[model samples]
Target: MSGQRRTATRSEHALEDLDGAALSYAARFAEQSEGRRRDHLRDELVQLALPFAGRLARRYRGRGEPLEDLEQVARLGLVKAVDRYDPERGSFTAYAAVTITGEIKRHFRDRTWGVHVPRRLQDLTIEVSQATAVLTSELSRSPTVAELAARLETSEEDILAALESAAGYTPASLNGPVGDDGPAELGDMFGALDADLESVDDRLTVSGLLYRLPARERRILAMRFYGNYTQSDIAAEFGISQMHVSRLLSRTLTWLRQAMLTDTPPRWESTGAPPEPPDAVTVSVDRADGRVQVGIRGELDRSAAERVRCALVDVVCAAGTDEVLVDLDGVGFIDAAGIAALLASHEAARRAAVRLRIADPQPYVRRSLIVAGLAPLFT
Candidate 1:
């Protein structure tokens, strides 16, 4: 044992001597003029100090960084020390050791964290880690938050925050396996698909389209879908037949489906037309000088809206017609369904590059259009 101690002492002395010689050489190299000779001497100095830098880098091993990368950082620091060293200020050996160690530490602090943490918290994390290790060894167990805070001379909140920040240093990969035996990933545990989320878009779309329907039809839809009422129940509440309720529901649903699928919503048709015959609405078309005049005569209610819209669309689609005038003077009354049909025909005319204008509308029909916000389009 005595012989081994002596041998170790000799090895230490030999290293000390080598370090002294290298420092002396570095000082000489710094004094040389900037030329090939100086460059050669600088290279020699770097080669001589490489082993010392490697030793400093080895002190940081098993710290998540690769040994080769740490050594590279240390060697870079050594080169900087050699270039910036002023021999008169201090000893090169001590200065180079500090510079290299600091470079290695900075590499870990700046680059190794998976998430950005404040500098203060990062330092606190290190101090807390060292304190926990020491306390665990002394007490033979993990230290509590209060114990850690006391040892670090900080509040328990700060200690807890530091503990949380430490996790940012090396976060687990989301793609990593959950366990040794499990095939699932860490991300798989986060959440599953929400069945209702798939219908969220449909719900939003239908909510907007529902207002376009007549109030009775809208009520019927709400009663059936939202209130979960049977057709017979809705029929009894509305004082209508079950067949009428079913027809209204079917028509409302079909219009909503078409509205959701298309940029232009289809015109609405009412199921409760008061036994009025189809001849109640009449349409006449006359063309002259590249213009077509369409005359509509009737109440222009839901029962007549679809017929008037179809006739106007046919007139607009006809070739060689640049302008269409819809005469609603003979119409005595109009409703939401009638307004929707006119708007639909206007949209069709606009797409077909034909100019369509409303020539005349009765006072009631004009007021209805104004209330529906369609008067501007007609004007």
Candidate 2:
């Protein structure tokens, strides 16, 4: 369920075909009872399912795990599914999917942790998860730090620190891929070695996506990453708060992720004559820490607003990114179209059940957001 944000609604789309075919083969093998026949069937099923395993492994690429490792974990899950699969229970595709997906998630919870952590931390996590879920069910919507504090009847400062620390302790963000093609699939997380795209070319693709950012973000990203400066150092260079720099770094990372890993696909529908999610705008990406921050700074005149709105919608709507920050800090002015774009982004974030934070509001940005009654939503 980590990657799967949207639940299966229409069964019409059907489970994967190869999985079904594999199940059919297994059934035929069972009928034959010949040793050779069963061996051939099992081998054939493995071959058929190899692609799905790769796809699943791709889903976990940037979550701080190696592709080879994730593939093995997913393969184990697939193999287990093959062993336990009962055609009577459900479609082989769906059943096997559950196993592989679970294995992928378990890897995040168990092995994905790169550093050793205290068992007490795991205990605390379990406690927090249960408490948060119960409180959320009662209160409606994800509980804020303050609301959770009240529920725990503890101090707000403690709650805030706990949340931050909770975030820091994870090996990889467990919320799933930053991008989603459909149902939090593997395609969203990993940039592919296409039929072409030699290894070096992939690096260029990522760099190309980075070039699309506004000059400030691009510079900040380069200095922070290449120069290896802390956000505080970057803040000093730019005369802004470390927090602001941190937020910008996050937004820039998401933009790059959208561009590199996810290829900035056309998730949003343009309202008018605006261009699609070209390299210039609407980069779809998954981040290293698993959270993504995006800044949409271009002029959202009426003609371009609709398309940009759709792109924002895609981010908010997708069951992708555990947390999303959409910064309006760079906008010099705001208009009705711009206001609409922000609202659309906010709604999509909520729908996806992600923590959406909007930071560093310019005067016009604040005014536009307030007029649209989005202050509570963003603040």
Candidate 3:
């Protein structure tokens, strides 16, 4: 015990010697003129105080920041103290120790948190941590939130919030391993892809396609699929035979499938109704200037599309006709079927080495062609 006391006494004497030397240097440094001599004095002062700054930095070790980084901060603070020290005010040793410790604390307050935290919460977090350590030592166990709150003289809610905010100081990485024995990571524990999300686009597409169908057919589809009605029930509701309902369902589904596959959908037609008479659509063909002009009148819908297609194909396939112009000045409306008919005629003309063009389409017809991506054919 006597030897230990002697060692501590010698250590205190050494510290006193260091403090006296540092004070004398600081006083001389402040008195000296601004030159190499003064700079040399200031540098010597910093060198003399380095071990003290290093000891202060060590107090902050195991607090998430690297020891090297803390030491760097402390050295910076020591330099600042040397440059701004006033020998008349107080001891240089006391001023530098405060400056260096404050610098280290400020580094933790501002730079260590992984996420932005309110200054109040940050200070509270440190208080809570210190309180936890003290309470754990006093009670020999972790303290409850109420005990912490009483010790900190704050509400339990504030203590809880501080504890939660403390987690933001060092967030766990998602890429980190989940367990000690396996390759699985923390990210792998998250929820998997939702199967229903994959069908969102298809559902939207089908909704638009369903709107394009005739009202009766739309109702039939809704009853069968949405209402969960059987084919016989649908046939009974519509006053049609079960076989007819079956055939209509088959054809409608086939058309919907084909429509969904293509950028442009097919036009809907009623199989129960009789075909439109040939006189409903008029096709007039005239040969002029080595080109056949085929003038079509009336609505170029599904009813008239086939007839128009056949007439245009015949004119295009004629050996003498090098070019054919299909005029649509009188056609008030056109549908997907009409566009399909025009496409078929264009294909036939291509095979026959004849140039087919569209001319004099009305405003509505022109817009329809543009929408169907056939405006270039008219130009």
The numbered model that scores best in lDDT is: 3
Candidate 1: global Cα-lDDT? 0.82
| Model 1 error, position 372 (Å) | 19
Candidate 2 residue runs with Cα over 4 Å from true position: 1-16, 34-36, 115-146, 150-379
lDDT of each: 0.82, 0.68, 0.84
TM-score of 1: 0.53
For all candidates, what are the clash counts? 0, 13, 0
- Give lDDT tens digits, candidate 3, residues 1-379: 9999998787666566766876788668768888899888877777767778898999989977899999999999999988888777888788888999998988998998999999999999989999999999999999999999999999999999999998999988889999898999998998899999999988877866664555577789989999999999999999998998888888878888998899967666666674333237799998778778889976788978999998888888883767788889867667799899999998998999988889999766798788887787884
Overall local distance difference test of candidate 3: 0.84
* Top-down lDDT ranking: 3, 1, 2
* TM per prediction: 0.53, 0.32, 0.53
Superposed on all Cα atoms, model 1 deviates from the true structure by an RMSD in Å of 10.5
Q: After aligning candidate 3 to the native by TM-score, how far in Å is the CA of 181 from where it should be?
A: 2.8
Q: Assess candidate 2 and give its lDDT.
A: 0.68
Candidates ranked by TM-score: 1, 3, 2
lDDT of 1 by residue, 1-379 (tens): 9999998787566557655766677667768887898888778778777878899999999989999999999999999988887667777889899999999999999999999999899999999999999999999999999999999899999999999999999999999998799699998989888999999999877765665565578788889988999999999999989998887888778888889999866666664464233238788888778778888876676777888888888888883677888888866656688888899998999999988888678655787778877676574
Error of 1 at 314 (Å): 25
lDDT of 2 at 55: 82
